[model samples]
Target: MSPAETALPDLVDSHCHLDFPDLVGELPEVIARARAAGVGRMVTICTRLKNEPAVRAIAEAHAPVFYAAGTHPMSAAEEPLATVGELVALARHPKFVGIGETGLDYHYTAESRAIQQVSLRLHIEAAQETGLPLIIHSRDADQDMEAILAEGMARKPYACVMHCFSSGPRLAEAALEMGFTLSISGIAAFPKSQELRDIFLRTPLDRLVLETDSPYLAPPPHRGKRNEPAYVAHTARALAPLFGLSLPEFAARTTANFDRLFPRAAGAQQAA
Candidate 1:
């Protein structure tokens, strides 16, 4: 095939924080780099309920960007608990594609576990009602996370993705069993992340997605520096081989998985 016909496949950064300080100020250039790297789409997550406007504005302003919002687990105790009604209202926006970056995070704010559980359940309800995927950010709270998610699903089924997943095998299994997808982040590309990578390797391809979680996990070469959507290619580069596919093939699958989970983004991309 001619090189023109063999172009690299486009990928989506399924979860990121474009509203964060490390990225919000330099969006134009950051987005430009992402496009140049074949990362043609992104989902910027809003961790605080108060900042949803700013986050929504980024999605509205950027054609390739969509957004999600919820009160983060770490701040669950500090912020007013997010209401299902509020989140359902937010999802009415054309560019609002997902429900949360919410889940438990006992690693830092274990004291807020009770409120976090309440917030997570509310987000779950919003997702269930609105038919939007829930973007979860879990850390060091695997057992409770599993229980709460399972309980919530039993109460009312909803779609979900374990964003930037680095939890244990049991949690992974639980999420997969619950029909939740797992997003591979730059953390999976770290030198010592073989265990995490192994877990991913065992996951079904259709249940996999990819993200930068940018301004956080930058992958190799750019490790320790502020991450951007462009760096997702590096994480893809590392993960694709393990899946027994070239970068383009893996990109295509993960991008398709992303579109399947976040249909609004797919619709917006199609409309664009």
Candidate 2:
């Protein structure tokens, strides 16, 4: 490894899309780069239930990679609704660590709001039943997202992390109030993300984790290009000072937060 890669603190990419085309064609190199940069683990998310098997295969083939399966909110209208039983069954996999990048995304598909809510609730129920953290992707529907999440908690508590949380403070506060975590992605490392950074600054360090959301939001030095897991270190490096932490200290805290939210992944790491 180069000096730069060697200097990176160990961290986890809590959410990414390794099975997606941009990364899948060069999976081994991508994973090797991640490890070289001290990204010790990653959770590749399956956005459609039909693609779970393929996503699972990626995790099984790579020691540091784990997987989660659910119907993404944006795809809810076109895809078949996921059954809670199905999600619970998938959670039985040793490497399957969380549920549903599922939640409301009314940004582009506002027409499908009703089905999106239905999908989000089903995913929440599965998280409640399986004891796995619910990985949420919310956008442009904060009111309904907050209300539904509250409704789920009212029925029964479940662990969750708001992935790529670039939403309003109200939603952030609501999720934190419900014992959920907020995942910091490369978006937080962008030059114009001061407002987003401010929101994270107010959040407790223990309630935060790190993700790449790759191949999507690559941080500075790689912005506007395809994102990869290794770039998560840049995000940690950028935000560490906000919490009065060194890079290693910030990485350790976020990795711990990830482990707390996704124990199965942590346990698997321990066993390995």
Candidate 3:
């Protein structure tokens, strides 16, 4: 075996889209590659609730994969609003690990902002009710995101993670204040992400996790290529140094953070 692969530590890809077209066609090979890279577990997200069955099937078929489902912010206007009961019902499945890939994204669908807010709150309620962590996707809507999340916390506390977090320091601080985690994606490894790196540097290591957001942010050495769970190892290698730890140490720490956020997946690991 290659030296790096031989010594690879177990790592979790906290967020990814294994059900998406780019990765789904090659699911078995993609999953095998992820395991080969020491990405021992992956949480494949279903952005639109209608696709939950297919996403769940992917998880059911793969021992190392788990899934979460919700309506994405950009699609909030077009899709039926998800109910707390509906999301909670999905949580009955042993492999369902979280409540969303939901939140606001004003970058492209600003006109749907209001509906997005409603959708986010509904997901929050689901998270609150299920005791599952909320997996958020915020983009160019930090202020409202902060307010709404804080508002939810005021009504009732719940666990949450800002998935593929590339927001400003203020949002990061707000999330941390609410005891939420910030998931690092390949964007943090880009040459131009020093500012983002500094934000992560300032954040507590325990309050962070790693994700590929694959089929999207591919990190270095493969930045322009289609990303998969296997590439999350590249991101881990790139960010470990920032936290003053070796790859294995960083991997262990982030995996622990992911476990804390997604206990259901951790439970699966223990069973195996």
lDDT, each prediction: 0.91, 0.93, 0.93
**Which stretches of model 3 miss by more than 4 angstroms?**
1-6, 270-272
**Residue range 145-253, candidate 3, lDDT tens digits:** 9999999999999999999999999999999999999999999999999999999999999999999998998998999999999888899899998788888889989
Error of 2 at 151 (Å): 0.1
lDDT of 2 by residue, 1-272 (tens): 56643576969999999999999999999999998888999999999999999999999999999999999999999999999999999999999999989999989999999999999999999999999999999999999999999999999999999999999999999999999999999999888999999999999989999999999999998999999999999999999998888888899889988888998888455222
The TM-score of predicted model 3 comes to 0.96
> Number of clashes in model 2?
0
TM per prediction? 0.97, 0.96, 0.96
> In terms of TM-score, how similar is model 2 to the real structure?
0.96
Candidate achieving higher lDDT, 1 or 2: 2
Candidate 3 lDDT score relative to the true structure: 0.93
Question: Cα RMSDs of all predictions?
Answer: 1.6, 2.4, 2.0
In candidate 1, the residue pairs with backbone N, CA or C atoms under 3 Å apart (3 or more residues apart, or in different chains) clash, namely none
